[model samples]
Target: MANTTTTTPNAAQDTLVLIGRALIAYLFIPAGIGKLMGFAGTVGYINSVGLPLPEVGAAIAILVELVLGIALLVGFKTRWTAIAMAIFTVAAALFFHKYWSAPDAMKMMQQINFNKNIAIAGGLLALSAFGPGRFSIDKK
Candidate 1:
């Protein structure tokens, strides 16, 4: 006589956490590389937005995307990294992606950036509150 049981909640949650990490990693890798290689004209674009410290902001953004992307991918300090990223995301959306009252063409681009930032920010917010689960460095 044998009995079968479903996976525990922790196991399911662990899998979900891994998926979330993967999602963030995939999204950020290109961004990190772009910043690292000065591709996509992101640095110049940041400055054009009238940011107070374009170089410093660009450097910080690169570091966050690289370091935090790696941390999230490996599930290390998941909550903390996620929280920092979430705040960063919101700040970026608010500052550069301001859609309201923007010109038609600019509005389209701002809308796109704004939407994507909000979505990614939501995921990071979830990670901040829910944690990375047992399949992470923080767990060990």
Candidate 2:
């Protein structure tokens, strides 16, 4: 008799992991592309937030979202890339999404964004712990 339960779950696990990677990477790719397209505006925003070296910050953001993001989507060196992304996510949340200090009108939006970043970071940490699963380049 076929051991249907075990086999199905493993296949499902691979597909789910791939989907998770895709969704997470999807968020970054468009964001990175937007930054590339609007470099000056991004720099202005970064500067407004009082981050040092807005240009450098923008560039690092681009690299993390586009370059490292692609690597993550492909599950290439998943754990390392996930860790980097997790760190970046936390830093960005702290730097850019300080909703607690925002004026009332803007506070809600910033709070949502801040919480979202934390959630994404949590997902990245989970990925780092689980690896890329069976279908990934870092296949377990």
Show where candidate 1 strays beyond 4 Å: 1-8
The 10-residue segment with the lowest total lDDT in model 1 = 1-10
Q: Tens digit of lDDT per residue, candidate 1, span 1-140?
A: 66786455578778988987988888887788888798447668887888877778888888788889999988888888998998888898998889996898799889999999999999998988878888889889
Whole-model lDDT per candidate = 0.86, 0.92
- Name the lDDT of candidate 2: 0.92
**Highest TM-score, which number?**
2
TM-score per model over all chains: 0.86, 0.90
lDDT (Cα, 0-100) at 35 in candidate 1: 88
